[model samples]
Target: MLSWVQKRGTSEHRTGLETPLQGPKQRCWFVWDPMGIIFAIATWALVLSGAWVLVRDLLIPSNNVFYAIANGVVFHLLASLALVSHLRTMLTDPGSVPLGNPPGPDTVSYCPFCLCAIPERVYHCTVCRRCIRKNDHHCPWVNNCVGEDNQKYFLLFTLYVGLMSTHVLLLLAIPVLRSHARGEWNASSTVSLPGPIFFLFLVALMGFIFALVMLCSQMCSIYKDKTTTEMLHQNKHSQGRQSMWANIKAICGPRVSLAWLSPFHSPDRYKVSERHVMA
Candidate 1:
């Protein structure tokens, strides 16, 4: 395949990524990997189930209508943001280099598996079946590779999830604390929670911890201007990179603002070329 690609004339290579099958493929961003699909489904199931339990068991039954309305609104808003961020992360293309692309002046190597020229900071993801620019580790939870284009959405997903989890934990704890303070509740006064409420507590606790840890790791990576893959492999080439704020801007957007927090906004610093598929 390498030989065939190499033997092709410049004009053939110049045709770029366009081909008969490219259009349909470009329209779909879903990865077909079984484990990724399963994890994605599980993620949606967890979010939906937890939200239902929170609303039906915890929020609706509250004695204070104002409290119930306020908490419910906040929880749903955070949950909606988290879900939107997850969808954007999964559906956005992660800056995959055009397959079978011709080597350029800055090309550092070639990916034999992909039969494409590999540029600096590019790594091939076997699961993605392509070379991704600034490729980070693939995330099963989001069912996508965290790479150049989609990193912003992934960060926002973690942030909102962590915030939502914290909110849930507070809602569960405050009432119990208040009862105890008034001497109306004690260890002997404690009663078992309903099944759905119990389930919600467990989910919130687990989600909080997971999101907290992942968010911290991702923030550190952004600060250091190194991806998880580069750090793990000890890629020396990543040294002498831009400063922390510059690196953050590069990934999130050109300027630091509320837009950086939005999953609907694309980073202006790195636009995908026409030759690249948006899949």
Candidate 2:
């Protein structure tokens, strides 16, 4: 672990590098957590199912099933793209670099990994294998450090994923209701085992439900202008309160929407208020 520390009576500071941190076991990569694997599989399943529905509709000419499938696919694609883009931005944003120096007094240089001057509230992530800007803890799900640049995207990803999940749930529920209303299944009808299609729908339903709940909770925390890490840290420190609403407004300013459409934005375009720093 690496850390930045400041001298008590002087402006001079230093960065400290500890023992090397290794990544998760190789098996972890291959057998990703069951939840993650399920989520990934469900995501791909939805995409393939959507495609099948579309192709089937084209071939049959009158099947509405394809239309429903197309809707689900589009919703998933947009949400997934938005979420991924946001995650990418968070992982690569340099600004997230925290504000001091490495551990040794004579070390004139900063850690290339973190890219921050280094001070309090900063730390290195073993997962990212780099010093983080304004270092927050590493998120295993994201497989990256959430620093200054990517914070906004991370928030956006959570928000959009929740919305997307809710949308998918609704979309799937609608067709299911219709099918039941038509009395397509009766006691006399043989109960076929749930196939890939049924399982895909089930997975999507469950994934979105879970994602939506988590996203909503995170959004509430973000709306208050705090990270999960920050919130937890606050419990142990005497830091002042942050105005989350104000931070949100600042990030979502006039040009904020542009973030969704494009990945490369001038840092200058995103104005950081003193209030944002306080948070």
What lDDT would each prediction earn against the true structure?
Answer: 0.79, 0.47
lDDT of 2: 0.47
* Worst 10-residue lDDT window, candidate 1: 270-279
In model 2, what is the error at residue 89, expressed in angstroms? 3.9
lDDT of 1 at 175: 84
Tens digits of lDDT, candidate 1, 80-121: 999999999999888777776665433456688877766567
How far off is residue 154 in model 2, in Å? 2.3
RMSD (CA, Å), candidate 1 to true, equals: 5.2
Tens-digit lDDT string for candidate 2 (1-279): 233332321233223342111223222212234554455455556545643543343323535667656764667576566556544543454233332233333222355565434433345655454554344455445544556556555555555555555665565467667877999867786644246445545645664675676566556655655555667767333132356654554444443456544334423334322322321
CA lDDT of 174 in candidate 2? 70
Tell how far residue 264 is off in model 1, in angstroms. 1.0
